[model samples]
Target: MSGFSPEWLALREPADHAAINAQVRLELVRVLAGKASPKVVDLGCGAGSNLRGLSPWLPAGQSWTLVDYDQRLLDAAQARVARSPLSPSPREGGGTSVTYRQADFSAGDFAPLIAGADLVTAAALFDLVSVPVIGKLADAVTANRQIFCTVLTYDGIASFLPEHPLDRAMREAFNRHQQTDKGFGPAAGPNATEALAQAFTSRGYRVIRAKSPWVLDQTFERLRRELDQGWANAVRETGAVPVREIEGWIAHRLAAQDAVTVVGHEDLLAVPV
Candidate 1:
């Protein structure tokens, strides 16, 4: 319910799954392989896309808790999980039991167990949070010696093929709008990965960072258009560009061959000692 539409989440899910770092995933799997039944808590889980993407990578007898502020998304996540190969109960051969909770992570509504979950997972979330919140997350994960795997955190990198003259302005304005408080105070936006990594590392956790940029070509026409429109809306929100230029830029970008967009994101895999 972070103002992100279900359509948008669905549109981006495939790209997110592909963006996960192979080496980082292997390291995380190795670390959790020893747990009899690993417990993973996904903060800010929207529509359960993270579960859909990562559950296959985990052991069958694991438990996953999906937390989000939006009840509607939670409902959708539960319903979708039921339909997915990762069913709610292990009895369904999913080898995983899924649970959903309506909670506000920014308000710190979770108990110690969630904070120190065996594996703390988040996707497309850190960028919307503040430094202090990330510090608190680090403290809890360190306290329980847990593994933290967060992916697709926006890193302020974007490019539009058949580049427009206003690309730079659009990106800068969008990034600035990203920094605006999305419930969390003064979001780190594109800067979240670095700040979160430093927080975890400073707390004695070993961390690895990997690039997970989204590379889109003409085949992904709808997703590409949405991304472009999303940026235009954000830039307009920031009042960084004139309305006429914004419309012109968006119109021009909408029609192009081999239209490719690389939106930069990073993944962090940290294991507390």
Candidate 2:
């Protein structure tokens, strides 16, 4: 409810899936390889995309707690888990089970869900949380001795080909704007992955980081256009450029339809020391 729309999330799900570091996911799956029916808690599990995306990489007996603030998203998530072929089916080994919870992790109490959890995971989430809250999550992971993995956190790398004069300025301003509160006082913005890794490391956990950037090509014109519009909106909101310039930038972006853009992201996996 407080985050992206289902339409946007659905539109980006495939890119998110492809952009996830496979090696990182393989390592995570390896860590929980021997566990019998691991209990996983996914923070901000919007529409169960992560579940569908990563479940196959994991063993069959995977059980997930898909937590989010919106009931509609949770319902959609439930429906997806029930119907998606990517999800473990009934006849499959052990199969996969899911439970939904409506709670905002931004400023909500989620310690209860971490208890007895084998893995605490989230995708595209760390950037939206504050430092103290991330520290609290680190403490909980240590207390429960659970694995923490987060993916698709923007790392401030944005590229547009046939560049415009305002490209760097607009991106820098937008990054600053990203720090504006998204429910967690001054979000980490581009520094999210580093902040989280540091939090777990200070608590004596070993962290693994991987690059998982989205490289949109000509084939992805629609997705790229939508993403560019989002950048335009972000830059506009920050008042970094005048409305006329912003419009011109947007126009240039659309004009360069064949341009390839790479949006950087990082994936993190932390395990107890």
- The model with the greatest TM-score is 2
For model 2, the superposed segments whose C-alpha errors exceed 4 Å read 85-92
- Tens-place lDDT per residue, model 2, 133-185, is 88888887887778999999999989888788978887898899889898878
Write the residue-wise lDDT of candidate 1 on 168-230 in tens digits: 889999999989998878998999999988998898889989888888877577898899898
**lDDT values for all models:** 0.84, 0.85
Model 2 TM-score?
0.95
Tell how far residue 64 is off in model 2, in angstroms.
0.5
lDDT of 1: 0.84
TM-score, each model? 0.94, 0.95
Number of the top candidate by lDDT? 2
Looking at model 2, residue 3 earns an lDDT score of 56
